[model samples]
Target: MKYVLFVYGDEKPWADAGAAEREAVYAQWGAYESLLTEHGARRGGNELAASATATTIRKQDGQVLITDGPFAETVEQISGYMVVEAADQAQAVEFAKAQPGEVFLRAVHDYGLDHLAPAEAPPGVRYTLLVYGPGGQETTPEQAAASAQEHYAYIELLLARGAFLDTVALQGLDTAALVRKPGVEVLITHGPFAETVEHLGGYYEIVAKDLDEAIELAKALPEPVVEVRPVVEYSG
Candidate 1:
């Protein structure tokens, strides 16, 4: 099976730390990655940028609205995440506890991303796989292309199997913000925080049989961390 480890922490320390101190902290993460590699449990992971530069977008009443900032404001911000292949929830929890901050572990559910489209989803709760990590801007163009190719192929396979619903690769923080009350003459702008760390770089909507099946799909992807959350069916 596979699991997504959402690593959260206060960004003040790292953001305020000296260059050397920050480097040391990064080194710690390197060590952790090495450990995962040694155990053959490291599927993928990443260190996101600060959350100061984010763009949020939304559409309503046939109009699209754009703004700046994350989807929510919180004290314990997401610092990073890791995608790991484990035996079960217990094993996944063990890996999370070893991380350097508070972590959240949620089982992936089997639901397709079709609900996001105009067509109705089949009779069942679907799942949305949120891919969080460093954006392509963090790397050289060549590297980003190569990494994207790997991910694209993985996605293609899922699509072929009728499991993929949608896939979107987002722009970097420089172009991030929030769009509130779209489709109106006037728009409100709530930009991203001044200090940005992590952004939702991309995402995938897929259908799986259950948590285990979802993990299997995640384990095959090349993303650093893939978050699987249940999509609630609204009757209203």
Candidate 2:
């Protein structure tokens, strides 16, 4: 099981500390992460920016309302998350309780509890691939001619095996968002995700045998870091 630790605390103490102290604290955190990786227990973690910059949104009476602030007002507010892969909840709890910082716990909620159904038809899953450094070079006549035949053949192999759900190479981040309110039809503003990362070059979605199988398939895809999570089928 993979568990998430949500950190909550006031930002004042750290801010009150001097720059050297803050750097030292970061160093300590880095050292702790190193220890976890060395012991083969760490998976991933991130230090999020402060909540003052957050924008909260919600749907109110058919209106998509937006607010500028953290989700709530409180002395202790969630700031970041750390994920750890463990054998079970008990083991995960034991590991988290021993962390140097105060942390709250939540299982990486597998929304697919009902998905334990019999594997009749192959599952319909989705994967997102992010590519970068397109090299900006236009295709030459010879290069284009050579790639056409080989690329078509390679694509045929995937289609023949039912492995290609769908694929698209994106232009840039400007195209990531989809318009939620449709303020402007041609200038629609929206995205599949919030915040931003290095590059969301592309994405893919396919069904596999199981979690492990899904990962195995995802790892083979061409993404620097492919996030793998199962889709929870809607039961009606």
Best-performing candidate as measured by TM-score: 1
Put down candidate 2 lDDT per residue, 102-219, tens digits, no spaces: 5545454333322332235344543222222232346688985674464346444444545555433333343232212222322223232233333333333345555455455544
| Cα lDDT, model 1, residue 116 | 44
Error of 1 at 11 (Å): 1.5
What lDDT does model 2 reach?
0.47
Evaluate residue 226 in candidate 2 and report its C-alpha lDDT on the 0 to 100 scale.
Answer: 44
Tens digits of per-residue lDDT, candidate 1, 1-236, equal 65556566677987789989977876877787887888799865545445444333333365434444434466665555577777876676667666655565443432343344325334333555556564434587898789878976887777666677665554445433222222343232322322434446566666767645655676566655555554433354
Q: In model 2, what is the error at residue 232, expressed in angstroms?
A: 30
The lDDT for every candidate, in the order shown, is 0.57, 0.47
User: Which predicted model would earn the best lDDT?
Assistant: 1
